[model samples]
Target: MTTPQTPILEARALTRSFGNVRALDGADFDIYPGEVVALIGDNGAGKSTMVKALSGSLALDSGEILFNGSPVDLDSPTAAADLGIETVFQDLALAPHLNAAQNMFLGREKPAKGILGRLGFMDAPTMRKESQAALDMLGATVRSLTDPVGAMSGGQQQAIAIARAVAWAKGVVFLDEPTAALGVVQTRNVLDTIRRVADNGVAVVFISHSMPHVMEVADRVQVLRMGKRVATLEAKKTSMEELVGAMTGATVGATS
Candidate 1:
């Protein structure tokens, strides 16, 4: 549970708004390479808003974002992607008709010559090879990359989505409620995948309200309340009751 040698992503005093909503007021956060930091909060606590700002899907009304300890302007999702930031939102966006390989290589196909460009060129062998490697990295047991993702189990589909991001992106990865809808075994699969990603030197931001899940997988935990970062602690040093109390602003609980 030690912090990384360097922070891959850091947000200092990050503030944003939608008209008078006043979402994410002076929120400060940082994610280190090879670490998974759980982000937890109650409803309307601005968790999604903070994630959007970091993903560059939404801009900060004020404050700053740092990539590799340097200031950065991630104006759009594409901009963030270019800097190796990938988001695995709950809606995976996989084409139900497309097979795992197709979904994994969606939009960012490797360029080659000939009809590969005409209509829709695909280097099938190469794409499948890459997809297989990514899946194997996380121990995904898929019968074939030719199988439609929709035909896969809830856990396998979730693995594919995370693998897709890992295959292409080399920087920070954000999991927005990744395990919310997974069954017990499936949830374990996703949690294992997250550890694998972090072990591979990619920083992971896991946004979840499930305190027990957070306790299980997070190296550290950040509690957000009223759109601000209220507390952060090493996972083992903090108890679930402490986390709950911190999020709820309950006194006579959390250790100082």
Candidate 2:
């Protein structure tokens, strides 16, 4: 396949530091549209810092963020989302008290048409319809639209979170440790959901420590060490041992 000409998201020279301890040291990364790019590394490999900078959770001490070929500043999470970049944290951010539709449309509510077509209420019906459609597109197994997210299984919750992002996202989605704490079946379910998201043409920056999972879904893999990108490789061209070595800096690019 030809390499993408326009990266959906790019971070260059990104740096972050706290009390002299640099969490990110000028890491460079990119995610192309409709591609699943794996971000992998050791415990302090700076993957989290890199993503936080992109997600607007953490401001970069230096460097630049580019979205859709334009240099932009993502100073806050809201700013990022406004530009069509969504993040699905490991927590899933579900409210047990809220049903799936409510959870999906939490902050952004549909406008309700009242007298003279003036907005006066929340459009629950449209929210439900759109939420269900998004979930269906993602192949989620949630049978009841009214079911509380808390009542759903881990896999279902994972799917719902992803589906919600897909419903609202127009550019790129950052997934943090998606398969963490999931059972084998749930893991498979989440992976499948991620695949469906990519199929819809949105870029994916998937953060994970699980090498096998990364290999299964990612088209490209980038390894970070001490906040620096050590290597980038085709998922098919690199093995787990080779990636682990690069991530751990065992022998740099080729596992010498």
Candidate 3:
């Protein structure tokens, strides 16, 4: 029998509110290493709020977040990044004018050696080499690493963005609407890359509205309704109708 793995990240009774609007109401989530979990819900279901809280982009009113089974405060985005957690929002967040390699090492640029390093000169060659390796690992194709990212196709740009996050992430990655507006080929490339990332032993929390894509890539589906997790189901064992029912509260009593 296979042993049950402990969750790499866990959220227990997480609660957040904006005035009278409760964004997260005793919500719960967990993800194991090397697993892909899809977080799904309709509008006002608190998917975005959950992502923000877990990514350390938003503060929680009450509840706890655990990393590797130990309580950890995700006080800020930097704090989450320090814990090897990364989030890729829908916008992609790439600098349009920068090349693939440049964007990958943007804020965390490799410095040059000797006095040049102290003088704030970047180590271009090393950054490019590492960036190329990361992209290659994800099987993401970019026509030119030297060319500006803005000139690349939508799929190519998405690939670069994901590769950058995967390169730096050590534990978990949260991707929000990653395949939203891409063409068929581009979406396929991104979905394939997501699988590769999980295969490499990092937990992936994929937030998407596309049931077909979610069912295609996720090992499990987590359904949220009215700011709480109502059900967690095995993707292969559950159908779209079941997932939609859970999201809409039509299917009750499903939990964890």
Give lDDT per model, in order. Answer: 0.83, 0.84, 0.89
> Which sequence of candidate numbers ranks them by TM-score, best first?
3, 2, 1
Best by lDDT: 3
Best by TM-score: 3
Predicted candidate 2 versus true structure: per-residue lDDT over 1-256, tens digit per residue: 3557978898888889988899998888988888998998999889878888898889778998898889998999899999889988888878888889998998897777766236457788889999988877765668577988888887778878878877788888888997775677667767887777788788888999889999999989988999988898889988999998887668677310
Better of 1 and 2 by lDDT: 2
Worst 10 residues of 3 by lDDT: 1-10
lDDT minimum window of 10 residues, candidate 2: 247-256
What C-alpha RMSD separates each model from the true structure? Answer: 2.8, 2.6, 2.0
Model 3: lDDT to the true structure: 0.89
Instruction: Give, for candidate 1, the lowest lDDT window spanning 10 residues.
Output: 247-256
lDDT by residue (177-245, candidate 1, tens digit) is 988767776677778888878888888899988888898898888888888888887898889888888
Query: Could you give candidate 3's per-residue lDDT for residues 1-256 as a string of tens digits?
Result: 1214678999999999999999899999999988999999999999999998888989899999999999999989899999999988777889999999999988788999999999999898999999999888766778999999999987788888888888888899998998876777768877888888888888999999999999999998999899999999989889999999998888853577
Model 1 stretches astray by more than 4 angstroms: 1-5, 112-120, 141-144, 147-156, 251-256
Give per-candidate clash totals: 1, 0, 0
Candidate 1 lDDT score relative to the true structure: 0.83
Of 2 and 3, the candidate ranking higher by lDDT: 3
